[model samples]
Target: MPNAMTKTTSLAQRLLRYGLYAILLVMAFVYLMPLWVMLLTSLKDVEEIRTGTLLSLPGSLNFDAWGKAWGSACTGGTCEGISPYLMNSFMIVIPAVVISTLLGALNGYVIAMWRFRGSELFFGLLLIGCFIPFQVVLLPMARTLSFFGLANTTTGLVMVHVVYGVAFTTLFFRNFYIALPKELISAARLDGAGFFRIFWRIVLPLSTPIIVVTVIWQFTQIWNDFLFGVVFSGFDTQPVTVALNNLVNTSFGGKQYNVDMAAALIAAAPTLLVYVFAGKYFVRGLTAGAVKG
Candidate 1:
């Protein structure tokens, strides 16, 4: 009787495990459906994409849409395609991420270690600045760019990113720095280390977690940014997001869903790849900076 009961309980546990596995498999399919559709649509010809059932395979597989999205698709009066926009976006985003992250690190170090008058209040104001909606400040920023003769240029877009991104980045760094050992800082100070010298040699090395978080956050923001690029970057400096938007908005007699999908995928590739690869590090950084002290 005891042996029979044990077998029954083991069998019941196995069934429960199987049920959970089934449910997870179904959930995975549900979430992946959109990406599956996009990939299939990209392979189909225009006519096939239009007439074929969404679940059905294309009549003929083709790479034309992919090529067109990357090199030949027309955008209104312009047809230079997604290539130039890709380069311009990288130019805008990379420098913005680099400069913002470095500045944030320096700000975090200064605020966490040094004694100054009303430093907390000043940082509190900066924190408030981050909460203001980007739309609220867009007009003022645009006007300022114009005043500086930087509007509608790559530099202008980067300037906007740096200005806004700093608040968030600084918060991350400041919080992370606060969690670090004050004795470490005090020792360095007693050794007559200047602020910049200590920051370069010691604090930065231990800030890997915050740095990864900052980079990932900034990359996603600047890469996928729409409003800033559209408002600040003219045709010559527009990133892929704006270019892709133009492609989406310029459909003619029939929509080129395949080409449009391909363009979106191309625009999204960098962020997607970064998150998939560096996601673990990003999460680790956030956990480490969670105010341990």
Candidate 2:
């Protein structure tokens, strides 16, 4: 009887594990359904798309839509496609990401490793910047940008992204640094290492995981930004997001769903690639950073 009971218990646990796996598979399919639809839609021409359901495979796979979307799609009166705006986004994102990450790292190191009065309060205030609604600052930011003659330029957009992104990056680095052993800093001081030397030689090398997280986060945030891009960018300096919007909203001969979907995929591709490649590091960094502080 005891032997029979053990067998039944093992069978039941196995069944439960299988059931959980099945549920997870279903949830993943649900999440991926939209992406599947978008790809399907983007492959079909306007005629086939009108006749077929969204989930149906294209009767004939068409690559012209992608080409058109990338090189000749209309945005208002301009038919120059998304290529230029894509370049503009890269320019803004790279500089903003690098500048913000560097500043955040310095700020985090000082706040975490050095002792000073009101430092905690200063960090707390910085955290508040992350929670505040960006909408609240648009007017003031615009005014300031105009005052500085940076309105509607790529430089202004980069500055805006860097300013907003720094708070989160600083928080990430600060938390990760807080978990580091204090003895390491003490030993470095004993070796007559100053702050910059200790940071460059000891701390920065150990910061690979958190640095990956900050770069990925900042890249995604700046790349996907539309509101600031729209408000701050000029006709010549608009980012991919704004261009994609213009392409979708422009009243052409007819609504080109395939072209719009293709444009969207192009706009989203870089960030998706970043997440796919560095997702493991992102998770590790978050876990490690949260372990202590």
Candidate 3:
């Protein structure tokens, strides 16, 4: 009787496990459907696109659309394609990520380890920036940029991203640092290490996990920012997202769905690559300090 009951329990657990797997599989399929469609559509010719349903596989692999999207398809008034705009996005993202991450680390180190009068209040005020909507700051930012002779420039865009991204980066670093052993900082000071010296020798070296998280977060956010790119960038300095929008809107003779799909993929490739490579690190970083404070 005991053996029969044990077999019955085992069967029930197996059924439950199978049910969960089925549900997850369905969810995964739903989420990946659009990407599958985009990839299929991008590889097909215009004729195939017009004739085939979204799920239909292309008869033959064609890369003409990808080439055109990269170098020749018209974006707005220029036929230069999204190549230059892609470079512009990289220019903005790299500097913004570096500056924001460094500033965040410094701010976090001070707030977390170097307690001072009113530091909590200062950190609170800084946290407000994280909650502020990008739309709310548009007018003020435009005016400030214009005043500083940076309006519609790539450098201005970089500065804007750096300022906005620092809050979140600071939050990540502060939380991570707060969970660290204070003895480390104290021991370093006892050893005659100054602020920057201690940070460089100890804290910063141990910051790899949080840094990966911050970099992935900032790179994804800055790289994928469309509204800020469009609003802050000049014609010549437009990012790939803006150029992709223009490419779709400015089609001359006919709407080329394949080219549009390919351009969209090109614009998204950077963030996708970042995630593909470092996504596990991102998850690990988020959980690194979870067990402590």
Error of 1 at 100 (Å): 0.6
Residue 211 shift from truth in candidate 2, angstroms: 0.6
Each candidate: how many clashes? 0, 0, 0
- How would you encode candidate 2's per-residue C-alpha lDDT over 1-293 as one tens digit per residue? 99999999999999999999999999999999999998988999999999889989998889888999999999877998898899999999999999999999999999999969999999999999899788988999999999999999999999999889899989989999999999999999999999999999999999998999999999998999999999889999999999999999997688889999999999999999999999999999888773358
C-alpha lDDT (0 to 100) for residue 290 of candidate 2: 32
**TM-scores of all models?**
0.92, 0.98, 0.97
Among all windows of 10 consecutive residues in model 2, the one with the lowest summed lDDT is 284-293
Q: What TM-score does model 3 achieve against the real structure?
A: 0.97
Question: What is the Cα-based lDDT of residue 156 in candidate 3?
Answer: 98
What's the lDDT of the predicted structure labeled candidate 2? 0.93
Query: lDDT-based ranking, best first?
Result: 3, 2, 1
Q: Score residue 60 of candidate 2 by CA lDDT.
A: 83
> If both were scored by lDDT, which would come out higher, candidate 1 or candidate 2?
2
Native-referenced Cα lDDT, model 1: 0.89
* Evaluation by TM-score, superior candidate among 1 and 3: 3
